[model samples]
Target: MFDFVPTRSDGDALREYAELFRASFPDAGHLNETYLKWLYSENPSGKVVGFDAYAEGRLAAHYVTVPADVFIQGVRQRGLLSLNTATHPDFQGKGLFTELARRTYERGAELGFNFVYGVANANSTPGFIRKLGFQLVRPLDAKISLGHVAKVDWPAVCRTAAFRRQWTEAHLAWRARNPQNAIRFASNRDGVLTAFASTDKPGVVVAGEFSPDGPVTALPCASVPILPRLFIGLLPEASRRRGLAIDVPKALRPSPLNLIYLSLDQKQKTLPADQIALSFLDFDAY
Candidate 1:
């Protein structure tokens, strides 16, 4: 029988975790050890949690949870964001992932989290939906705008006392929390600052307020008809080479967004018939 434990700040334990991740997803490319170290480090004010499963004396599976505050129906709610779940290929079908995930969910609930989120790919979504009984929320709305200048005028925007204070705090917080992720900031000639946060796969431009006092609003550019096409156009050649497919929200399709299909829980009261489909991104595992 294997034992599951929360990974404390042990260097050896973390190295084992990284090795397991690489072995589990050999095609995902390099994930630097330094990056994983920073990710597992704890902050009193931050919202990241790490766990590991051990079989005999070796690490078998690992996962991380990121605490996010999401707005649902104009109310700010706490969300548990699951990421980087992996198990050694040698341990496949041994139920390590399922065991680890259930324990993680219980721990998250104990920590006062209301929802669990994850983005699953084609191989794992069905099991998450069928076996775990996780309800599918609405497909995340993602839009992209191209011809975007890669540069920004940070100095000019920093001139404003309010903008400078908020920008500095947000930037630092983001960096400290997401050491493995890339965050870019820029400003235009009009002194309007824009911030973007992305992983190697998908990118999101931070536009509106995401705080308790702030109201959630989609980006103005998100409404542009060409945004979807622009996003599809921007996929990295490497991702396309590997057969990465973009999953678009159903409501956004056919109008300007050109989304393909959407995933929703059939048991959910609000789901529309014929509009629901299997999600490429699993909400429970994100």
Candidate 2:
């Protein structure tokens, strides 16, 4: 039999949990104590939770939940951001993740969250689909519009301090980590960095970029309302053809931001089953 328990953010047990996470998701690269601390400490809404699985007195699996503020039809709604779920290699096929996820959902209900969200990759999508009954709701799409780039005011953009800081950090990180891809940022007159977008792949533009490290702030009114649209227009032509996939929110119809939708229950006949994958973000962990 296995033991499942909630973990707090202190002590050797938490340290062991962190180690297991690092080993399980190495592709995250540069995920250390500092990054995790930043995520928990700087979260604006203060909603984060964690669960750990134990077998034979050793930590074996883990999962976390984060609170996300999403906008639908101009109304802000709260969502449960499910992230960083992993099982130790030795413990695979034992249904540890499934059991823990069930518990997580129960906790989410108690906490008053309406829906759960995650970004799953190829390896774990099947389990989330077959076992957990999560459906594929959104597939990401990208489009490059060079005509929009020509209208941007580079001088005004550089003048804003907040925009400068966000641009500098985001651009440098993208260059170092994704040298081949392009990144862009936009600011309102009040100096708030209101808009950010990136192209991480050669011909793909991923918009809806934000500073992953801090809380989102309100931006000043744009002198030209179409600045955000212009930023999206700068994406490479080939990238426009190769769009990405994303999960859609339950209440909202498909738009640029919320493109996909998934249901945890299989009896609901809303979205197609085959194209979706289970997702968990690394940063959302407690």
Candidate 3:
């Protein structure tokens, strides 16, 4: 049997979260105390909401939802970004994953959040759909551009898009402090693009490009990818084919990323996949 405790943002809790994270995921070493503090505690939107399972006083499994404000149907609403989930090897077959999510979502709804969403990889898609009642919206497009990638009119795109993550200056500042790597931001007379070193490969991932203040910030970059790598977000539904970018085939990608959503209010319909615009910056892609 396991006891599920609500996750908290405190000195002891932060340490435990980081400890559990490193124990649960092989590549979670970078998510130490400092990183967890910034992620789970310092979000400008809201605090992290989730549960930690303890078995005989040992932290065995955990799941957390990062709070975010998103535009659903062009209307801004409070939402939860379904993120970090981990279970120690010994705790695997006890239904902790779904139960943790269930309780977390329950708590999220209690906190008055409108929806919960995330980018789910191929392996986790079925579990989310068949088990967790989430809709597998669409497979995110992956494109690689050795040079400049074309920019779309974001205001125009937002008008047609079914969903978009709300980005404020505060949110942008919090994201830039990520301990994982440095995000290089480039601006242009048209828009702004942010790229960071990809942990998976030897290049940078274009986080996302934005048209903010209702206008362009600085001059456009000579080339998009400063390191000449890839951009793993929406390329077709939201962007166009220009510059040196080519769509990466499914077979070539190490793993396929799919956007998934579950509305806290059952009355709200699942947002359409086709109109959703995403990028690494939108979620925990780093």
Candidate 4:
């Protein structure tokens, strides 16, 4: 029998998790304690929720999800962003991931989390959808822009998307503190857009157009951009009003990312890809 306990957010525990993570993915950069602490401990949305299973006093597997608030029909509701999960090599065929996820969602529902969502890669998409009963919303589009993004209507986009991420100053700030990617921002007369230097291509800057404050009004942008290079994110239909972005070749991407969702309350929900506003900042993949 496996012993289960709530995942801890302490330094030592995070370090231990990182160790197991490194054992699975050796070249990972986000293995430092600082990154783990910021993600599981310092997130403003809420503390981490998941479980760790032990067998004979050894950690057999670990899984966790972070809390987030999403706007559904203009009302805020609790949500969980399905995140890290790892099991030792010795325990690979035991179906630990499915079991751990099932346990996590049960606790999440008890704590008022309405649903769970995540960006899954090609290899894991099957397990999430077939084994865990997640809905395949859509795949993230890969686009490349040359130092350009036309004026965007954030409020309109938010409303059209039906599922909107509630972005507060605290949550945005917490997102900017990622140790692995030094997320920067450039604010002009229009509004704030998060940016980060991309290592895949030198001199290529990935940017996300987002309104940090409320969407009461629209902001104007200068004809010029400070770090005009390439923009990568969910560019709403409004963004195409006047911009130059071409679809990036699928061959360039390591793997296609698909958005997956599961309703904890067993209520059906629809999240159209064209409507949701998402960026690398919204997920941990970057």
CA lDDT of each prediction against the hidden true structure: 0.45, 0.45, 0.76, 0.75
Candidate 4: tens digits of C-alpha lDDT, residues 81-158: 998999988888898888999999999999989999898999999999999899988888777766555557765766
Sort by TM-score, top down from the best: 3, 4, 1, 2
* lDDT top scorer: 3
Q: lDDT of model 3 at residue 39? A: 89
Model 3, range 1-286, lDDT digits (tens) per residue?
A: 8998998889998888788877777686887888888889899998899998999999888899999988777788899998888888888888999999999999999999999988888898889999999988888878776665555766676676677777666676677778776455666555555545455665555546754423323322234445655666663355443666778877888888888899998756697766776778778787
lDDT score at residue 149, model 3, on the 0-100 scale? 54
* 1-286 per-residue lDDT for model 1 (tens digits): 7888975546786677678877988775445467665555543224466577888988888877765543332234455556668888878788877777777777776776655555554466666667655544333334333433223223322221110112234323444344544433344444343334432334333221111122213222223122212122111111112222244554644433111111122221222222221111112111
Model 2 clash tally? 15
For model 1, the run of ten residues with the poorest summed lDDT: 277-286
List CA RMSD, all candidates: 11.3, 11.1, 2.9, 3.5
Error of 3 at 118 (Å): 1.0
Off by over 4 Å in 1: 42-47, 140-144, 147-168, 171-181, 187-193, 197-286
lDDT of model number 3:
0.76
Backbone clashes in model 1, listed as residue pairs: 82-286, 117-286, 118-285, 118-286, 119-286, 120-282, 152-186, 152-187, 153-187
Candidate 2 structure quality by residue, lDDT tens digits, 1-286: 8888974555465467668877787775434554454443345544466677898998899877665554322223455556667788888888888888878777766675555655454566666667766654543332333323222333332332111112233222322232222233454443334333332334433333222333334322222233222122121121122333332333432234222223232223343322221111111211
Superposition error at 37 for model 3 (Å): 0.6
Model 4 per-residue lDDT at 57:
82
TM-score of each: 0.58, 0.57, 0.89, 0.89
Error of 2 at 149 (Å): 9.4
